[model samples]
Target chain A: MEFDMTKPVPETQPWSEKFWEGTKQGKLLIQVCKDCKSKIFYPRKFCPECWSGNLDWIEASGKAKIFTFSTAYDMVEPKFTDELPYTIAYVDLEEGIRMMTRIIECKPEDIRIDMEVEVVFQERGGYFLPYFRPVGKK
Target chain B: MSKGKIAIIGIGEVPTRNMPERTHWDIIYDTCMEAIKDSGLHKNDIEGAISVTPQAQPKIAAELSFGKLPEELGLKGCKDAVSVNAGGASTSNAIRLAEQWITSGIAKAVLVHHVTVHSTIPIPDLINFFARAGVDLQWEYPYGTTYNIIMGLMANRYMHESDCKPEEMASVVTALRSWAAKDTNSFFYGKEVPSVEKVLASALLNTPLHKRESNVLGDGGSAMVIVSAEDAKKMKRPAAYKLGDSVRYFSGTCVMRDFYKVAEGFVVTAKEAMAQAGITKEDVSLWNCYLAYPLAHPLIAELLEVAPQGMGGKYFLEGRMSFGGDIPWSSIGDAPGRGHTGSGVSTACYVETARQLMGKAGERQVKNCKYVYQNAGGGSGFNNIATIWGKEI
Candidate 1:
């Protein structure tokens, strides 16, 4: 029997297309405020702080600090059955905003809050995804 | 800063365990009405509102004002509102937002609501798989870790570092069961308490962490209404005032950090709360700390240096956490107990705190409780908040 899980599969909306593009470049990209001086992640057209319509995309420094993280042993989904006991994290970018991403190339016990990490790029489903490995490990 | 003079004029909860009959809006409406009734205020008195949850978009909940929740509850006049997403910290954030709104003169009174239907929300099995397959899934899901695993790891490390043990952790279950046994409204009401043996014998999801250390799931909604102390004084009933609140974020490299310490954010927020309230750790009589797992309590205690290294045991052994004592703790312990309810547990923590303050906590009420410490965790560990609630704010 397949493991039952919750949450509907997310569908890609048109506005999010660009987000997929930046991942392939091995660079993390997020929105920057045009009117006021601010940076945002997870790509948006306007500034969350100032609500400024003036916004543009900028590449990130590929640096992050592990804010908090978790590990999973249960393969609640079939696609994840083989990857049980993996790690996920909430990486706080040096730029201020936080993004949800996965950590790779490290043991679960090695992950900790405030761990420095750098981003790596990979392609999936014809789209780009941003993941991270320990800064010095790779 | 209403300058610490705001009371929780009303309190409402839709239900915790399960409610198949109610939609998210339906539960929100019910809890809102209950709060309105408790406050003795009409809808028009409410000039502001905050909805905390990602389950329902803020705009949808905002549109709910057209119905009885706001209209009949006398909130048709609300001028300021927001849908703040702080993960588990939503309730405390809601309280802070309400206080700011009232103090800023944006509105006289505000309603803060948090509702969750975890069963209704999707938890993808391949969440980590999808992310690691590289669509930028590095924070939590990449390693295929769920919230439980992360908490369990913390628990494992905490026990390894502290004097507490799995048996002592079982006290949380015993205490919660004892309280739930008394509260007929609780999800675990009438349930038998799990023996320490049972906790140890249970299958381990993460080493040193049993399945019984987490909170369970049930559909529910919670709401609180706040008014100025001046307005509260005019009411026929005595009021519940805003004592103080603080929100803190943690950032540092995991490498240089000590393994035994609680998350730096937890300590910072506790101090921030103390600073804001003009009180010391000694002044807080009721500590309603977050307990997503057993490790959180000890981690916070160790980090804050509030209690000596061994003080964590006294509270854990006595089941003070499960009973909702100062640093009163609750978590859907493991797979056996009430599992994670997502934002629902966040609301439940405040509900328990409010109940204790109002002297409505019945069997779980701590003696002479004057000050309460409530903390909420959120966003894969990036966000946290600690709130200080006092009887005479």
Candidate 2:
């Protein structure tokens, strides 16, 4: 059954717009503290480590490894019903930042902690949503 | 302020179930009135009030709707009134705030109130509420990371790191169900306790989380009245003194912290509260660790040093967390069996602990329950509050 892909879209704030725009352009951008060189995810206005406002964005390598994962077989939102058994995972990027994303192109049972994976963008609701899949898989 | 300066003199809780007909305000009113009556004090004696809710509604909304609990409940001399919105940690945080108010002379008597009516809303709306309340809306919610999924991720990581078998996780549920069966107010009351095999065979809501392992959400309300130590002595009933309290914070997201070290904030908050109480783990007579998810029981146990790290499941398997165990944990059932009602968990924990300390818990009471340690966390370990309640100053 085909499900409605018109799920809730994020209301981007001024600071996070660039990160979303980068995702649309097929590049994973992460914020970095200009002073302390500490990498940050989810695009915060100030550096969590150094409290530095002098921040810059760097394109991530689009590579990460699965830190942990869970597959939802039931009790999901109606909009997500068609995507039954979808795997949600937290992946550790090589830059030392962790991202919450979906894992596709593999059986749910095959997903394992610390397994290497890479980012892939899927267009939804006129926006590019980043998901991850096991490395070396089509 | 020094420890044991404030005491929970009275507590009350409304029956927990799916009460779609009742509004959140209605439940709050009922619980607060019941608590005041239990305290044997006039409403005019309440000088301060703290309200807690987990939905997107702000504290101001509660006051605007409920008309300042002090006024609605006919409190004539109320001087301070505030609403707390720390999610699951709101009740514990509210209790801590009440203690501070009594210690600072801001108020001689304070009432802490909590209510949740999520079941009154539509399922989809409730799901949306959970997503918006706990997840990072701009980045995580859009990606479909709901609260259950976040817990699922945590459970998966915890199992992987601890090498905790599926059967051991199921045992946590089995044991909690047995406890709930004994509590008349528990959602699982009158229900047959599920065996470990039954729990393991239950349908999986999310991979690694059986249907029995997740929280059974419901609607409920609870209230507690706290007064200065001097006033507590004059109360009609025995009082549960506030020995120590601490609130700690960590990353808002599960991915930000080391997955293997999931209980970092719990450990910090527990230690701080214990130290402030001038007590150690051995001194605690009862333990009320929040168990919204069965996987959290062992993790929190390990964090609190009730059991060795990675050996919490073993503690449960050996029947150590049961009523007859050396350390009586969740004798009235944790969230999974008692029912998860937003801020009601912590408030209910306080009420249960007070009852045990006062020798009021008939069947579920623990022996020698003098010092009761109750702890709660909010938003997937983003915030935590630990409180120690003693039978004496």
Candidate 3:
């Protein structure tokens, strides 16, 4: 059973609507702090570090390095079970914040602690979800 | 300059569940009542309460139980009640809050509880939230990068760093299984401990880290009533005093800055807590460390100088968990026995130490145990907390 890509999201808070909207634009948007100039993920209005209200939205280039990662052989969910072995990774963005993304177009064994990767957006249902691929290689 | 003195006067815990069926509310109610009962006090006696749970609406405590709260355990004349959200660190961190309130003379007694219906919630999906926060969530969660895999990454790195064999980790599983087999309260009662060969042969969730090393997703809740030393003496239940505690955050999730810093940092935290408790590692009769993976023990041991270089194995020659027994994470080989519970796992270990201290643990009790050491690791690969608890504060 492939995860029904068309399944409606069961819940969505008001603030998170922007995040969902970003996927539609094929752009990854993250909040940036004014005081400390740090990037915030998890879609929060305030910065957790300095409690800075001076925040701005910035588009990311999505180029990152795999600080560490793992490949799953089992499918706990049926949505993507057909592709039994898949790689999920912690990609350290040039911005200094590491975001979790899937490594596409690379063998599981090829994933190293410091591999360079770039974001590739895919259209999942109506949302353009961001996955990553190796920079030089296909 | 306020001296914060918070003593856990009364403790209440539900029987552990193989797969927790009840809602967070059900578990909270049960443990809260047990704690209030243990305190020999009524709901009205509680002046302040604090809680940390997976649920967002903590005021449910007041709504469910007569205009009172932390959660249905019911506290009357309450002025200060907070719902903290620090994951596994929440329970003990709640203790820190209680100490603050009591030292300020704000609340004479504070009730803190953590519970969850593990079977009901989508465990895998929820754990993926941490991933969504950092990584490209849409990509990582869809195919691979769940918390388990993230830990697998850490475990892989750890294994590469040390000579810790899979068999040594399996021995940890065997010891946990051995203890759980004896504990009617444990989920794996009567189950045979998997042999080293069996563990090695198990599915590799992450390279060199087998599936058995993780914790079984069990359900349960644990409650502790924190009070001042004077208040504890008046309480009916025997107390497990908070001798000393510390919370430290390592920089970044990556292993760059604070990763290697953990071993030395752990020793510092432990030494500080021990010094405050007026005891040394030599005085600790039992040790219940939070073993997320097999690599933590040796890494921690090496860092603490528990043994000289390359002799970390010698420290475990004689102990409750010889060679790193039943770790709490992944239950990869059931090292800590059951797989992880969100919060209660750490609290339960503390409860186990409390049981041993009170002479309540039947067969598993350590002899002449006066002090017990408890460690709680939060946001794996990032936050670490250590606390020392004893019969005397």
Candidate 4:
């Protein structure tokens, strides 16, 4: 499939390149501070908790639970207008890291706080963006 | 940060409405002059200047950055001038900066002002711009979350944890808007006070939030003058004395922030500011917690313990936050009732507080106003700058 130009094409920095590369291979990678032993998301160059550059990556299990969510009935970015009635959420991964993503394969009424979810990737240009789905969904 | 030794002697604002007719420079100049005139002082009386950093810059909120405000305002060799940014806390942070200059005798007085234009950009693009600012451009913006959507997520979690209901949210909106309806200064002035049903019927921008639930930005700007107590006495004008002060900027972006940490931030800021003011929550005559959205109604109430758990909605519904109500909230209706003046809304909150303390809030003034507790922030709720004010030093 041709990459859609209408979709948001994310650029990667040096520290976030690995996470983007992992996504291209359909692997979810997260950062952990070797200094503080704290897991980090969003691929910062330094650990937010400890401000240490001594960070390493580990493959995330992709297991998560909905911390909170909201379904957009209207008023989204122009590019995402076609995906209206979409549910956006923040989920707490099993690794104790929180990340923002869209919830696919769920209805506005069915989504509940604390509901278990899993990650899936959608390709965008040279990278894949991670989105969450209810557990066991293909 | 001063020990009630400095006070806001003058305040100014333009109407809170879409004014494509006026450039940001015009708005800034108009409001600044209004404030200087209201202060009963010559323009040269202000020797120090502090500005709240403009928002959504290079398009609408641009061109006014750096420390050029004093020069732009024609201050002759001003002693000091700088800009401060902390999201909604911008103006509050600017006020603290002014206090430092005034108390340190770096300047006889300081002018703190803000301008965030919303009319220059199209609505959708504007939403996209603010959304990108609030989240990580790489990780989160691609996921299609606007400020409204992020706030929606927060509103859901807060409502779920606290058992806040949709009807209660409407009630809170209604109460907040009534204050706006009473004040000629509010954009919503002379507009019908929205009923709870009207709020429920309003279009939904995101789950659990009607279009009216959030503080959508508008073309607005405000300014204020902070002078030493000696100046206030010489002028023989009642001033809103700066008492306690606490300003903080925590983690950036709401998704990455810890809720408990922010909750603790609120408590700590409130405690420290109140302690410095030598007062308790009971002593506060007015409360202004930047309630950018409705859930903030209950959320702030609960965080500040103004209302018991999950009862913030009921508290608003009961009219406890309205004019003549216990701890009247936002004399001129604040962001939800007044219009969100970009960064200036926080400055405007202080303006309204000063008006109430000076017995000049017009029809919307809260009676017996003495002490005011205000918290303004960016990142929705991630950061906080809480301060206390009194009628006299």
lDDT of 2 by residue, A1-138 (tens): 333446877777777888878989999999888999988877778887888999999999989999889899887777777788899998889988888899999999888999999999988777788899889888
- Tens digits of lDDT, candidate 1, B227-323: 8777876774645555666665543222113332336667777888778887888787676666555546655655656556766655656655555
Q: Which candidate is the best by DockQ?
A: 4
By lDDT rank, best first, the candidates go: 4, 2, 1, 3
| Model 1 lDDT per residue over A13-129, tens place | 454556666676666777788888687654455676798888777777889987666665552345555666666666778887676667889988887778899988756555555
lDDT at residue B7 of model 1 (Cα atoms): 75
Task: Indicate the worst ten consecutive residues by lDDT in candidate 3 chain B.
Answer: B326-335
Candidates' C-alpha lDDT? 0.63, 0.80, 0.62, 0.81
Model 3 superposed RMSD (Cα): 5.9
Please report, as a value between 0 and 1, the fraction of native contacts recovered by candidate 3.
0.27
Please tell me the interface RMSD, in Å, for model 2: 3.9
Q: On residues B1-393, what C-alpha lDDT tens digit does candidate 2 reach at each position?
A: 368788888787787788789887788788888888888788888999888755643443456335466777778989878877676777777877887888888999898888777665666566656656767766677666666788888878888888878888888887787788888778888789888889888898887888888888888878888898789987757889888887767667665656434466678777888888999989999888775778778877888889898898888887788756677898767888888887678778888888888788888888878898898777766767788888988
- Name model 2 segments beyond 4 Å from true: A1-5, B21-26, B54-66, B234-236, B260-262
Lowest summed lDDT across 10 adjacent residues in model 1 chain B is found at: B251-260
Q: Which residue pairs of candidate 4 clash?
A: none
Off by over 4 Å in 3: A1-68, A75-80, A89-138, B1-4, B18-26, B40-43, B55-80, B122-143, B233-237, B251-258, B261-264, B291-298, B307-339, B380-382
Report the C-alpha displacement of residue B287, candidate 2, in angstroms: 1.1
* Candidates ranked, most accurate by TM-score first: 4, 2, 3, 1
User: Tens digit of lDDT per residue, candidate 4, span A9-107?
Assistant: 775789999998898898999988899998888788899888999999999999999999999988776678788999989999998889888899887
Ranking, DockQ, top scorer first: 4, 2, 3, 1
Estimate the lDDT of model 2.
Answer: 0.80
* Model 4 regions more than 4 Å off: A1-5, B57-63, B66-74, B122-125
TM-score of 4: 0.94
